[model samples]
Target: MKVGVKDLWAGGILIFLALLGLFINGGLLGIGLESHALGTARRMGPGYMPMLVFWLQLGLGCLVVFNAFSNGPDPLERWTKLDLTTLAISVSSGVILWRVMEAIGLNNNYIQVGAPCFVAMAVLAISPAWRPLGLVLASFAIFGLLLEPLGLILALVGLCVVSALADRDHNPVSVIGMTVSLCIICWFVFIYELDIRVPLWPTIF
Candidate 1:
């Protein structure tokens, strides 16, 4: 009845994330759900789905921990110096660049472009095997960073391109189709139908 180290670590992380989400959802630390109500299941408040998800995650994490004790001997993988360096440098570069730009009151296109570039390059340089993870992280970060300066359409396009690049088997036609479909759907649902205030083009335009 030995504990599987890998499963133990995985389950611990899942439990931690679930607890963090529950704390936020329940307003335990005054982080989130401040104004949102926790209405009944039938009524379905804004916090209802997230609370349910966190509970499910907690249950799944507990099950995984239980299984870890019952499962065979699987050890945890050690993070190399390069792995830690890659993560630290990549994340810090983007966040530091963003903070510097915001502090200087220069929320320009350069900050939006530079941050993700730094992240992608650092990840690729240090750990080429983690290309998909790096690409996905950079893509989402780019989308968030560029949403204000470059607008929704360009941000979505950037997201699609970078994310598609993550998959080695991704086709150009499929990427194009997905990009177009996403743009149209977002435009219709978020801007037109929902009347949300969002920019459609570059701020310069």
Candidate 2:
């Protein structure tokens, strides 16, 4: 008994995504550059949130490329080997979160609603296996915890944890090394320069 190659289409998509991510994250999104102060917060326009998002997306894309490449994708096949369970969970969770958004008044309190969505997305990325899923969820929970109520430190710690989990081995030394490096880089762009108002924890409204 053996596995024929997975669909060539998926493999090609994976590779194409990698290249797209690499270029966008490294250059287009300006990951390594500095940004000007946002200037205003009330009357109209240019919010810290958008800059925060740009940085996050840049980071995601870069990390995605790393993930796609490190997996050493299998050869392409005509037939597709779909992971329907994972896809189903992700899509369902996303749609449900969006629907619940209006009920929860997420439009007004974006942070509260967004925190759970972030956690769900991360958790669903893993299969239903508890050991792995629990670990991932725990990290995300800590992130949301820190990102609410107060300061930047806890969120930073959570960020470090989540970033480390992205790797397969979760080797402590390497994870720590990578985490610290990414944190410093992010801090330089988002904190020192852009000065985005990231909550350490969310205050209840």
At residue 31, candidate 2 shows an lDDT of: 47
Error at 166, model 2, angstroms: 2.9
Collision count for each candidate, in order: 0, 9
Per-candidate TM-scores read 0.60, 0.48
RMSD of each: 5.7, 8.7
Q: Residue by residue across 42-100, what tens digits does model 2's lDDT show?
A: 32134344444554655555555455454545555232223456556666775677677
- Model 1 C-alpha lDDT per residue in residues 1-205, reported as the tens digit of each score: 6879878887888899998887878744446534467677546577776888888988899999889998959986677777777777777776776777677786765665567564655465456555777887678777876787889999999999988888889999999999999999999877887655778998789
Look at candidate 1 and tell me the lDDT of residue 52. 81
How much lDDT does each candidate structure score?
A: 0.77, 0.55
Sum up the clashes in candidate 1. Answer: 0
What alpha-carbon RMSD in Å does predicted model 1 have with respect to the real structure?
Answer: 5.7
